[model samples]
Target: MKVLLASPRGFCAGVNMAIDSLEIALKAFGPPLYVYHEIVHNKYVVTHFREKGVEFVDHLEEVPHGATLLFSAHGVSPEVREAARERNLTAIDATCPLVTKVHLEAIKYARQGYTIFLIGHEGHDEVVGTMGEAPEAIVLVETPEDVAGLTVADETKLAYLTQTTLSVDDANRIISRLKERFPQIASPPKDDICYATQNRQEAVALLCSEANLVLVLGSQNSSNSQRLAELARERGVAAHLIDGAGDIEAQWLDGVETVLVTAGASAPEVVVEECLDFLRDHYGAEVEVRTTREEHVSFPLPKELRAVSVE
Candidate 1:
């Protein structure tokens, strides 16, 4: 078997910032630190942090008053921020700047009395956070079919924004439908899908062309990770989304000739390495590293934590 490892895969800039912020926080504030959600959507990352004494919580009620709390990379709505403030919790926002851009756009559209359409999956942490920005003005639009039934008070006063981690092709398809239905719908200066998401997907699509099987390393709840596997299956290639190498089934390798391995933005490269080791020891897989694109993007830690010494 031959292994094709993907480039521009795993731990994008936003994930880097979020993870680093937590590490710095841990050093300065110590364990028992509370995070609003899973720091990033990787089971290993969350479990690693959990074992280190970081407490991941879903609600403000789960955190004690005045405790230091860091928001997840998937940005939070003003309401969540306000609630944190109400409890006097020292909140350090680790929201990706790209996601923050969408929230700001939502606020701007809502303030302008424009009905906003957000293209994202329902119940996703980022979607939920973005929706909380202007629940009254923002309507969640999941599919092109959903666009058909959408009603607006005034089509003239309409705008559309998207979740940063959405599949690029999917978002484009939905946007096309929105434009056809509401010609006047305003769009952001640039598409909201983050560079890392688009780059990883592009890499996967390129490598998927030659591989008999594609393996995506990511947690189930990860939006970007799910899209990678779905994109492969959509391309007529067999793919599986697994948290790590342990999830790989022996039957999956039955007739596989070439395999493509990649990781989601939140996944760590160590997990990717472990997977490669497994493939080599068991199948004697020959490995080739390929690059579809080069990524140099980076993000700085939250300002409040700058003073907190980071190792």
Candidate 2:
């Protein structure tokens, strides 16, 4: 068996910074650390943190007053931050800078009296948080069809922003539709989809040409990971999004000579290694790496964790 591993596949700069922030917080704040959402939407990363005493809560009421709460990389709305403050919780922001960029854009457009159309999956943590930024000013559009049915008080004053982890092709399709319906639709100065997402998708698409099946290493809920699998299937290749090596079924390997492996932006590299190990041990797979491009972006730790010395 042959395995093609994708470079620049897992743990983008934002995920690394978020994970490192939590690690520093865990050391500085001691036990019982509380996180607003799954740190990065990866099952392995969240489960690992949970084992290390990080409490993942969906609601602020579940967190104790005066506790230290870390926001997930998905980024929280101003409302969530205010609730954390109301409870006297020491909140540390771990939201990805890219996601934060979209939030800022939403705030910008809303402040200017423009109706913002957010291109993202409905109910996604990032989308939910972003919409909360300007609830009354922003409208969620999941598909181009949603764009067709859009009702706006002012089409002349319209703008669009997208979730950071959205599929590039999907976002572009939606953006194109938005443009067709409303040529005056304004866009963010830069693309909203994070660089890591585009890179991983492009890398996987390249690998798909040589593989009989593609294995995406990420949790079921991971948006970018799902895109990796979706990208492959769109190209008529078999693909699966598995949380880790254990989730891989033997039937998936049947009649498969080559497997392309890639991880989502939030996925941990250790899980990718584990999946590789599984394929190597079971099928004696030979590995080859496909590099799309090198990424050097990094974000500074939250102010609260900057002074903490983590071993």
Provide the lDDT at 310 for model 2: 39
lDDT of 2 by residue, 196-295 (tens): 9999999987779999999999888999999999999999999999988999999999989999999999888899999999999999999999888898
**Could you give the C-alpha RMSD of every candidate to the true structure, in order shown?**
1.0, 1.1
Model 2, C-alpha of 59: deviation from truth (Å): 0.8
Alpha carbon lDDT of residue 113, candidate 1? Answer: 100
lDDT score for candidate 2 against the true structure: 0.91
Write the residue-wise lDDT of candidate 1 on 7-72 in tens digits.
Answer: 989999999999999988988889799999899999999999999899999999999999999999
The 10 consecutive residues of candidate 1 with the worst lDDT sum are 302-311
Cα lDDT computed for each candidate against the true fold: 0.94, 0.91
- Which parts of model 1 have CA positions greater than 4 angstroms off? none
